[model samples]
Target: MASFEVKGGNKLNGTIVPQGAKNEALQIISAVLLTAEEVTVSNIPDILDVNLLIELLEDMGVKVSRPSRDTCIFKADAVDADYLASEAFRNKGGKLRGSVMVAGPMLARFKKAFIPKPGGDKIGRRRLDTHIIGFEKLGAQFDYHDEEGFFQLSSPRLKGTFMLLDEPSVTGTANIVMAATLAEGTTTIYNAACEPYVQQLCKMLNSMGARISGIGSNLLTIEGVTALGGTSHRMLPDMIEVGSFIGMAAMTQSEITIKGAGVEHLGVIPDKFRQLGIQLEIRGDDIYIPAQEKYEITTFLDGSVLTVYDHPWPGFTPDLLSIMLVVATQAVGSVLIHQKMFESRLFFVDKLLDMGAQIILCDPHRATVIGLGRKHKLRGITMSSPDIRAGQALLIAALSAEGTSIIQNIEQIDRGYQYIDERLRQLGAEIRRL
Candidate 1:
């Protein structure tokens, strides 16, 4: 129930470091379950979702210790199978979507796993069929228990096989990859999600003695190893957070530099912001966005209206589409934001409309924003955060407004952004957590 009391029209100026990638942390942390040996992970983001997964691991008898706030040492040698069937585990495991990841490693090493209905941002329908089907393809028997609301999966032995995924799901690919790492034969996954998160997992698994190829492509091949040993891994800086900072700097007319942003791995994020006419400089591993009174959107080469849409990796990320929509509010021209990944994410634009921005919600999947061009400033209003990305988008809107705005459901914001209000305060933002 925490809320952010944000005073608008404050021009932020400072250097902010993006936290470790939350998406990658979930998969990497779960991979620790593959071995009983010590696995050390550095640059872990101190956020709710990631912490919840870590706690779930601790509850399952994984020996975990933190050498630093951002580093975790885990030894899963004594993971308790009984804990997975316990009511406590059911409740807690159900609360985090990432907990499903543990099922893969658990099934791979322990031969049995149970997954409850996973909880996360209610953006749209997130299916687990991909995971279940992939597991089944790897020789696991899957059964759904309606009374307990859990998927019961078990196998005497796992043998790898070829799989063509219906879609390139990031978590699904990670889960299946972790399982296939210890299978009896080789596995080939085509049309797989090859985002940086997946590539990092593959690289880490390779270091752990798993044979994996196609590091950055849709086709991935893995040769099963009998056992995986432990290795140290570091997470990349969150690309979503980096993109959010770019939008915030542009909308608030602030000069801010994001340090250690993992620039090379960002993959089209900076260019997407530039599509909105947000100027940014890539220096070493940092991104510098300067203050601007007004920016304009870029049109297609044939003189059609500009459109920013989400696609698979190497394309614009859906997570940052919300930030792009919010940043487009005060820009000099209009742009179409196509949120193809999720249907309900565009619903949050109604809140921006209340603040006097010109936006046309063409449908559940699309929004057309006619930038005010900074001729009129957005006035503050009370709003509630809907999801992690939308919440951050709303916070950006509130920060660039003309007065104080109260944002409820900031817990959603905390689940993704680490100490966001405190970080913004360092940039001279007048934000209070209540």
Candidate 2:
């Protein structure tokens, strides 16, 4: 039960190197179960979720060792399939949504997988139907226990075929990708999620000798291989953290540079932030955000109001919607933000309203934010974080407020961002975690 006490009104002026992507690390670690050889992953973030996933892997008899601060070696040569049914596995699996991803590789390599209901941010109903339906299409049979809320998937041999996901669920796409990589035949997944995390999974699979085409598109063609060998791969930078840093720099009128921000991978992030009148300058692989006293939200053509919303890949990511909402509070114009993927994501607007931001909660999924635009600095107050994204949003709001602010329930933030308070503190933010 940690909390963050932030003293605001400080202009953060320095450079920040974003940590490895948490979402990507989750999928990549699960991919280790696809092979028996040792898979070395570098640039691993020291976060709660990653540590929990590592524990889950070790419980499955995968030899996990950390040779360096940001490196880990995983060998699944003698992994115990029964560990998936252990109480430790069930408890940890039920605590994190990313735990569902292990189902594919576990079922693919060991012929069966047992997973409890996964838990994550209670923003909306994150259905596992996509994962189950995708696996079922590949010739796997599922037996679900409703009372226990557990799922058992078994398949003697998986024969890949065509799979059209009902929607572009990120984890669903990753699950199917991991499953199809070792199936008996080629698997074609249409309308797959092509986010960077999914892309990283595909890259890791390819490096391990899995043939996967359509790297950056909705249609993924995976040629199932007999077996995959181990390989070393570095995780990508956390794009969500990059976006958060951008918002922090803008809100606090700071000039900060984000290093190792693979600008090429930021498919729609730059333009999406441009909608909020935030301009970024790119220097090779770095992103520089200059100080801004007043920011304004851009309007649409024909004198109409524009709304910022989340969509599938190449569109804005749903993960950053909370940051967008918080940043919008300081902008000069009005913008309606619609979080289509999650219902309760917009509920955090109440806290912002309490800080003197003009926000109207239309419903669970929508919020209309009227920017005070530097006319009024948000007054610091105590708030509780309801989810990961909301926690980061509250951190940014606290950093930009006029007085001291206390944020409880920092575990949600730790689940995603790595060493967030330390990193922000390095950038001259007065944030302390206790």
For each candidate, what is the lDDT?
A: 0.94, 0.91
Across 1-434, the per-residue lDDT of candidate 1 in tens digits comes to 88999999988999999999999999999999999999999999999999999999999999999988899999998999778877898899887888899889999999999998888898998889999999999999988888888888999999989999999999999999999999999999999999999999999999999999988999999999999999999999999999999999999999999999999999999988998998999999999998888899999999899999999998888999999999999999899999998889999998999999999999999999999999988989999999999999999999999999999999999999999998999999999999
List ranges where model 2 is wrong by over 4 Å: none
Error of 2 at 80 (Å): 0.6
Alpha-carbon error at 288 in model 1, in Å? 1.0
Clashing pairs in 1: none
What's the lDDT for candidate 2? Answer: 0.91
For model 1, give the 10-residue run with minimal summed lDDT. Answer: 81-90
List, residue by residue over 133-216, the lDDT tens digit for candidate 2: 999999999998887788999999999899888998889999999999889999999999999899999999999999999998
Clash count for each candidate, listed in order shown: 0, 0
Choose the strongest candidate by TM-score.
1
The list of candidate 1 runs beyond 4 A from truth reads none
